[model samples]
Target: MNLVLTVLEITAPVFLLAAVGFTWVKLGFEYRVEFVTRLAMTLSVPCLIFVALMRTDIEPSALTTLTLAAITAYGVLTVLCFALVKLAKLDIRTFLAPLIMGNTGNLGLPVALFAFGDQGLGYAVVVFAIMGIYSFTFGIWIVSGGGSPTKAIKEPLVGATLLGALFLWQGWETPTFLTNAIELIGQMAIPMMLITLGVAVARLSPANLGRAVWLSVLRVGLCVAAATVVGLWFALPSVALAVLIVQVSTPVAVTSYLIAEKYGADSQDVAGLVVVSTLLSIVTIPLTLAFLV
Candidate 1:
């Protein structure tokens, strides 16, 4: 019972803010998704990542282990998803990216922050960084049917992650005034993302949800299993392991749909996967957290 309440407390604000966006969209309010996304990614998210990494209490070595663990887990997920898509005879371009990459940023970061406080956010940021780089580079390649991976370098969060990691390693801190300013911007990340997520979902026109349902279930199982194996193999502490599982098992990202649309893949199919998987998460996330918390 205590665990149930703890899980609820951690999850409530996240979905609630998202609900606000969803309802706002339904009521015909104008929320510019592309603009909000640009603002968050270009400014707020970078600050959040830098601040989290700089303020983290986790040792650099533990972070290194988590970093390696996240990479391996993603590698395993890539292989597994590829095989699943091939066996199912689905278009790899449309399905693989969404399956391999979860909503680690908008969904995963907030969940980690609420569940495990700053330490968890710190760990979550590491995984988010890894995912961001991988998704931008290789994920774009897969979605676009071959492309230069250099675009990942253009993302502001990439620089922030590197700079923040450097700060952690060298025991550096920004001046108090700058830190406060950066943190104030960073504070916008979670709510902005959650609301944007809701807005995006409300606007999406999904397709073939019956197929998406089974694929989404398979995705959740495979992702959590891969993370669990990698986390245990690395002997991650409880919080790290829980964060890994939760992040990996997050729903399909809205970015996946946009990438598919931009690259002329089957965006409708990807949209279905995103919507079905996200709604399913309302159940799967709490159950997983109940056990983990």
Candidate 2:
């Protein structure tokens, strides 16, 4: 009973913010997704990642372990998703990336923050960074049929991750005033991302709802299994382990639908995955948290 309330406390703000965006869009209000996304990715999100990584009090060794574990977990998920797509006779290009990469940023970070506080946010950032790098590089290549690794390197998120990791390693701190400014900007990222998610979903028109439902179920099951195996293999600490499970098991990201639309890989199908998986998270996240907490 107590755990149920705890999970509610953690997830309510996230969905509520997203609901605001959804309702705003349904009511025929204007919200420019491209501009908001660009702002978050280029500025706010990078700031958030940098600040979280820079100020994290977790041991360096623990961070490294979690990083390797996250990489391995994603690697396993990619292979598994590919096999599933092939066997299911699905369009590999359309289904593969979304299945492999979860919504670790917009959804995962905030959940981690609310559920486990700052340290969980710190651990969540590491997983999100790894996933972001993979999504920009390999995920793009899969969607577009070809992409450059340099594109990932050019992303501000990647740069922020590298810089933040360096700062963490060296035990360095930015000047107080500068740190405060950066933190303020970083603080905007969570709500903006959540709201953007709702806006994006509101605008999307998902197709093949029946198929999407089952596929989304498969994605959740496979991701949770892979993350659990990898976390146990790495002997991750309790908090890091919980973060791993939650982040990896998050719903399909709305970005996947955007990528599919841009690359002409059946955007409607991808949109279905995003909508179904995200809706599924309202139930799955709470249940998973009930166990983890």
Candidate 3:
């Protein structure tokens, strides 16, 4: 019962609300869904990241570990997914993005907050930093299929991160006006994200369910295994290891679908992958955490 409530508290409410929103879209609230997701991706999310990074108190040692961990996890996953494409003779473009990009920011952040409180959130911040940049850079490149690696190397969020870190380093508190503005915008991030998730869910079809589920299980399972080994090898604090395990185990990111749609890849498959992995994650997350935590 306690575990059930805990899951509800951490994950289910947003998802339930998402279902409601999904129903609304099914009934023709399509514009609202687009508005919410765009608001999140363009405004609220960046504000949230700026505020979180600004307020987080990071340690140098932890930052180092986070960089190493992020690189190892993502790098290994990329190579493995590429190999899987070759070995399985699957559509490389269709599977690679969803397989390699887990929902590290949205789901990962909440799990960290639940598991380790402020310290866990702190660890999540560092992990978010590394993964966020990599996602924008390497992620865009891999999914874009532009045939030029340079296109993926630009770092838009790097400026935001550096500015936030500069303030953190200076120990400067955000002035009332700036903080208030950020708070206002950041407050919308979750609702917008959930609404987007709802709309994305609404768009999923049965066509790709089988392959998507199989790929999702393979991607998430391998991600957890690799993260666990790396965490153990690096001797991360148990709580930090627990956090990494959950983060890496998260479903194919919602953004994976968006990116696929953008790149004219297999958007249906990516969307299906997102739905399958997210549904399965409720069980996988706690199971992995129970053992690792």
Give the best candidate by lDDT: 1
In order of listing, the candidates' clash counts read 0, 0, 0
Q: Model 3 segments beyond 4 Å from truth?
A: 1-8, 32-34, 147-156
Q: What is the lDDT of residue 158 in candidate 1?
A: 89
The TM-score measured for candidate 1 stands at: 0.99
What is candidate 1's CA lDDT for residue 50? 99
lDDT of 3 by residue, 147-211 (tens): 34443334433455566666666777788898999869876765666556667677766346887
Better of 2 and 3 by TM-score: 2
True-structure lDDT of candidate 1: 0.95
Please report, as a residue range, the 10-residue window in candidate 3 with the lowest summed lDDT: 149-158
User: lDDT per prediction?
Assistant: 0.95, 0.93, 0.70
Over the stretch 1-293, how does candidate 1's per-residue lDDT look in tens digits?
78888989999998999999999999999999999999999999999999999999999999999999999999999999999999999998899999999999999999999999999999999999889989998988998867666888888998999999999999999999999999999999999999999999999999999999999999999999999999999999999999999999999999999999999999999999999999999989999998888
